[model samples]
Target: MTLLALAGCSSPDGGSQASPTITTTAAQATTAASKPGSRIFGLSDNQTAALDYLTTLEDRHAPFVSDDRLLALHRGGEICVDLDNGMSFSDLVASWKPELREDGAKLYVRAAVEKLCQDNRSKVPA
Candidate 1:
């Protein structure tokens, strides 16, 4: 869900602006908790670690990166994971659509997800 939230927030333009801050707000996490089917609530230890890793990367690179580049990296990561897991990107996204209903919140989360995906690309199966 965090990935979906982040992926949704990215801009298509190559402009530089502040990346959205992710609040550990109750509503955001609540939305995930309300949805039994979502993968975002109370993230597994591994997921939290991955999210932290990506967030660190985003913090380091956001000032120098374009939204478009970040989006591309996110997409690339999605493609790799989809291929590795035999899951369609659309379907994967669809599952999170209900939880990631707000586009603005999504914009904030995209850059982080992109960096995470980019870094994890090598884990994709051949």
Candidate 2:
């Protein structure tokens, strides 16, 4: 929940960084992914597409673009870990700061789960 709000590689003991996230058309995602250096090496093209996809989301609901991409990946992994552990939607939402509670937040989380958190992709909240 609130943990997702933190950028990658962040924890309660450490502060988080800012990044951009939000909605985009599949075409935009593809176009972004096509650009050289658009993706960090070591990730599959699909994975990179996912990252680019996240960037197109509405920032208020899924703010992820302004942060370092590596850290963003870290956060997505953490979210998957929690999901794998049976973290619930209620609990997830409870962890959010009031201002961070946006309707699209769940969708944002789901996209990360599906794209970045492969093992937990099926665990996305209902």
Candidate 3:
């Protein structure tokens, strides 16, 4: 999916140059599973794990997509998901809805999810 499509964009701060748009294919979205089965605060294990992973990735990569757009990308197959993971991609996307207002964290989380889903989908039998 097109992580960023802007050309010669300036940072929101008005001085720093924005990072170039980064695009990743399903093949480039692979991610290792880290969190195990353990629901937290009513969230499923998969949802919790996804959130954790996204947060970690966010610290390193500033996201260029919105939470809603990210989910759309996943649903549209721009992002892939592993059916063997025993997690519902829909549920994972839904879990992110509540946090959409959490500053810029949601953007990073969404981008992470997109890559993760793409990676998962690519691994499935096709």
Candidate 4:
């Protein structure tokens, strides 16, 4: 009876959720993105210019892109760039759907980006 009860208690799905395995490449990128400094790589001149412009905006503002904000923005951009060179916030989040099930860190990274983007929308060039 106890054995039957135990079996009955098992999840109908038959397996526990699996954790996401953050790839070494992703990890490295994340580390770089999370760093407390300006990031200059893999950007076209235009993109670099745009980033520079944003930095200027940050400097002008009282609560500019702090370390955490920079990390989130950079990491989010990295994930987007990896999934699709021209990926936007919506696109990157969509691509990371599968990863969210396994690892929440990706979601965290994405959220950080979203927040940064939201906060900096005024600074973004049209």
Candidate 5:
């Protein structure tokens, strides 16, 4: 979870900023998420939930193409931060999705707001 938060603090120019590396096996991610306050792999429940939500998006044919798991999660965190800064749904949809189609963009935005920025859910239009 710390890694997820750390990875997002990068240069806006998309320069050669070094990414934080987190090395853990699949079993470690699962085990770390299951135990409360147990950050063996540094994956908290909220972090794991966001990651799992992304998996569902992929299942629904809205997959994001990042081989590194943290990259996807970091992007999700960025979406949440945008919402924190009062970026509306329409604006988020327009700015957040880079290579994704309309449907995929909606999925990504909705999933990020739901899992990562739940407090702002009611602010979004249904």
Candidate 6:
């Protein structure tokens, strides 16, 4: 009886638990996707440039900015941009390529940025 119980416990299908490894890349991708429109908010060139500078500084000196500053910049940029000019979320997503690349934020950053732009645009006066 004890031998049978041990055998059952040791069975490959019975005791093997599938462990999903979450790598930094995977986590970053998940974070980017889950947040949707959270990194870029369709800012104008001036606003984009200023935020870019701030983000660069944060990236160089303050890693914490990676977590919160980017979101704040996105919000501020959305407020600064004149959305009545017909800018779409797709445009903002495309525009974020440089920043995303610089930050190593994952490929989905573009999609997230675009989603954010779209979400912000949705709230604008149409």
lDDT assessment of candidate 6:
0.38
By TM-score rank, best first, the candidates go: 5, 2, 1, 6, 4, 3
Off by over 4 Å in 5: 1-47, 66-68
Tell me the spans in candidate 6 whose CA falls farther than 4 Å from its real position: 1-71, 74-76, 79-82, 101-126
- Which candidate number has the best lDDT? 5
Q: Give the runs in model 3 whose Cα sits over 4 Å from its true position.
A: 1-84, 101-110, 113-117, 122-126
lDDT (10s digit) by residue, model 4, range 1-84:
211221233346886544333233544444444432323232221233224333443443313223333443345445534433
In terms of lDDT, the poorest run of 10 residues in model 3 is 34-43
Residue 71 of model 3, lDDT score: 41
- State TM-scores per candidate: 0.25, 0.44, 0.24, 0.24, 0.57, 0.25
Error of 2 at 94 (Å): 2.5
lDDT of 1 at 80: 38
Residue 37 shift from truth in candidate 1, angstroms: 22
User: Per-residue lDDT for 6-114 in model 6, tens only?
Assistant: 1232436567543433233545534432343333342322333334434453444422334554454454445325233445544544565455543333223322233
**CA lDDT of 58 in candidate 6?**
46
Work out candidate 2's RMSD over C-alphas.
11.6
lDDT of 3 by residue, 1-126 (tens): 233422244767787575644443433222233111211111121333344444445454543346433343333222223233454545544454554434334443344444344334433332
Give Cα distance to truth, residue 120, candidate 5, Å.
1.2
For model 4, the superposed segments whose C-alpha errors exceed 4 Å read 1-77, 80-85, 102-110, 114-126
Question: Model 1, stretches more than 4 Å misplaced?
Answer: 1-83, 102-113, 119-126
What 10-residue stretch in candidate 5 is worst by lDDT?
A: 36-45
- Each candidate's number of clashing pairs is 5, 17, 5, 1, 1, 1
In candidate 2, stretches whose alpha carbon ends up further than 4 angstroms from where it belongs are 1-53, 56-61, 65-70
Write the residue-wise lDDT of candidate 1 on 5-122 in tens digits.
5434345695554555455555544433222233232233124334654555455443213444334334324433443455543454454356443342233234323333343233
- Superposed on all Cα atoms, model 6 deviates from the true structure by an RMSD in Å of 17.6
Model 4 is weakest, by summed lDDT over 10 consecutive residues, at: 1-10
Model 6 is weakest, by summed lDDT over 10 consecutive residues, at 1-10
